[model samples]
Target: MSFEVGQKVAGKVTGITHFGAFVSLPDNKTGLIHISEISDSYIKDINTVLTVGQEVEVKVLTIAADGKISLSLRQANEQAKPETTGRPKPAFNKENDRNYNKQPQSDQAPRFNKSSAAPSRSSYTPNQNNSPKKEGDFDSLMSGFLKDSEDRLSSLRRNTEGKRGGRGGRRS
Candidate 1:
């Protein structure tokens, strides 16, 4: 069978080295499952999960242009499980899996009174009684912001007005 990236296939562990394990793929092709790809968790010893001549299912993660193959055991197991079909039925643990695909709707009832949790339309109407307040509306916001900016600039200027201003007070 032809192997494609992301396709899971059975392979035989032909040899094991300290670095990784060599697997003979289904079509007489060989691939390496790196020590890091041997499992989902940290692997202190590759022998714990793999043995010479052991048959295992693995996913093809990459096939280099020069024909080098990279496989992953974690991906194969994840793909082996069955997925759900779209049809409402009794509650099942599988429902949890669906959560990964979509976010749940809000559980709280919608507020209709327009007093609590509802945006006050009057606050953003621009020209009507509920228009938003711009800085010029109060004539103070712009002044405050400008004053703060001026104060910071003045402080910075005063700090740099000394002989220790450039290059951290260096003579150069």
Candidate 2:
């Protein structure tokens, strides 16, 4: 029987390699399941995940012109399981959005109360003697970032210029 892409087929693991596993499909066809496709998580050893003569349900991923079939063990397993999200999402509509944020709603999480969190403005004022604040100026922020990067590069060079000894070093 011929297999098409995305077709779930039952097969027996015929061989295992460091990179993947060879599975014998019907009609004497064989497919390779790459190590990455073996599991949802990392599999340190292919043997640990599969063995010769083990039955598995694999989804056909690709059928190359050269008669090579790429299969996925994980994809087939995912198909067998149903997804579960705790709460059903509300359908988006203009009416629901218009009422949002006007008042507190039980369904929504509590919003951060800015007024309650901060001290009264009359109680806290900046001292006139302090340096000018750099908040909200794009030019000042960009220049500060560039200056810090330049200083870091200069210090890194100072620390590594001698330790990076290699054939590229200039002849004295």
Using TM-score, give the best candidate's number: 2
Score each candidate by Cα lDDT: 0.79, 0.88
Q: Write model 2 residue lDDT over 14-131, tens digit each, in one string.
A: 9999999999999999999999999999999999889999999999999999999999999999999899767998898866697766777689877787767878787642433344
Query: Mind giving the per-residue lDDT tens digits that candidate 1 earns over 1-172?
Result: 7778988888899999888999998777999999988877998888888999999999899999888899988778867778867787866676577676675468956556556656666544432343355546555766755766787788887788666656456464
What is residue 157's positional error in candidate 2, in angstroms?
Answer: 20
Q: What residue pairs are clashing in model 2?
A: none
TM-score of each: 0.47, 0.52
Model 1 gets an lDDT of 0.79
- Give residue 142's error in model 1 in angstroms: 23
| RMSD per model, one decimal | 11.6, 10.7
